[model samples]
Target: MFLSTILDKPVCQPIKKPYERWYTFMEKNVEFWLPDSEWHTKAHCARVLLLALLIGHQKGLSEEEKDALGMAAVFHDSRRHDDGIDKGHGSRAAAYYKEYCREHGLSYDAQTYYITYYHDQDDSLGLSEIAKSSDLSEQAVLLYQIFKDADALDRFRLGPDGLDENFLRTEEARQLVDFAKDLLQKSNETNA
Candidate 1:
């Protein structure tokens, strides 16, 4: 056949180097969590990390903030038990991250854990209020928002029009939805 049915959608292949680094980190640290059913697999984590980093960079987040965000994205769904809604998964993932950091003698900022622990939970408090009450900087709040939105953008894995642009936190993130889905589809093909 000259054409394939799956070739209909555009694919935005992300730059290799940065994703390679994140992939390596996941392979080294989260091998156990990588293999799973569709919704919460390594591919999902990779896409979220890529999108979160892109948003963070565009928003002028410091390198430290980017690092934390990346870590948070990768680990956010690591503890998921199934594709259905699972409570306490985020907490378990955050605990895993802490133990992983400790064992590796690496230090992560508190925002990293906060993001990881709350990624799946939609908090009642606004970001500004949370930022004001906590020790988190504005940049940290931005990172958290980007991390959450990046993950949400991957709702394409759920089916048609699964990503709700209205919930997207930043303009950059909202604009990247199609591109992000393209990248994610490519990633899934490679992994499959």
Candidate 2:
């Protein structure tokens, strides 16, 4: 499979049958700073997006919430500079997401922005920020958790201890542990 470095091209090939549409959309639409990044490639974002949607559905999230989750997933690591501890990548991605939405004439979702901004931070910090914020809704908090868990699920690509089920924010995510692993394996095979 030939991956394109052009910003206008799809970031990667679709990973799964059920998620092809989303994978294609995100791969084509989202902008990655490091298109050649091995760890934070478009395939990783697509898997995270799929996990987020599945977990959101299980949690009975509204269409709007799911949309936010989708946006959060695709943009979460868009600004990552390295595969290691790139601490402020989330904030950079959030800023990019805001500008992207504005330029594309899409609705700017605060929930999505917040989720993206704080995703790389500690869970306690994110939760506390949500709790203290006057503008953030309870739904935003849940979306944050869902997005975090969804991103974490894709950590299987990191190796054996990449994912710790106990760290998963939602029960739905915890339940998807085996499935997440399988998804990673299958996606790797497809990409291979």
- Evaluated with TM-score, which candidate comes out highest? 2
In order of appearance, the predictions have TM-scores of 0.84, 0.87
lDDT of 2 at 91: 96
lDDT top scorer: 2
In model 2, which range of ten residues has the least summed lDDT?
Answer: 1-10
lDDT of 2 at 77: 91
lDDT of 2 by residue, 21-79 (tens): 55666778888988889899888887788788788878878878888888888889999
Error of 1 at 165 (Å): 0.9
Question: Worst 10-residue stretch by lDDT in candidate 1?
Answer: 1-10
Flag regions of model 1 displaced more than 4 Å: 1-16, 31-34, 125-134
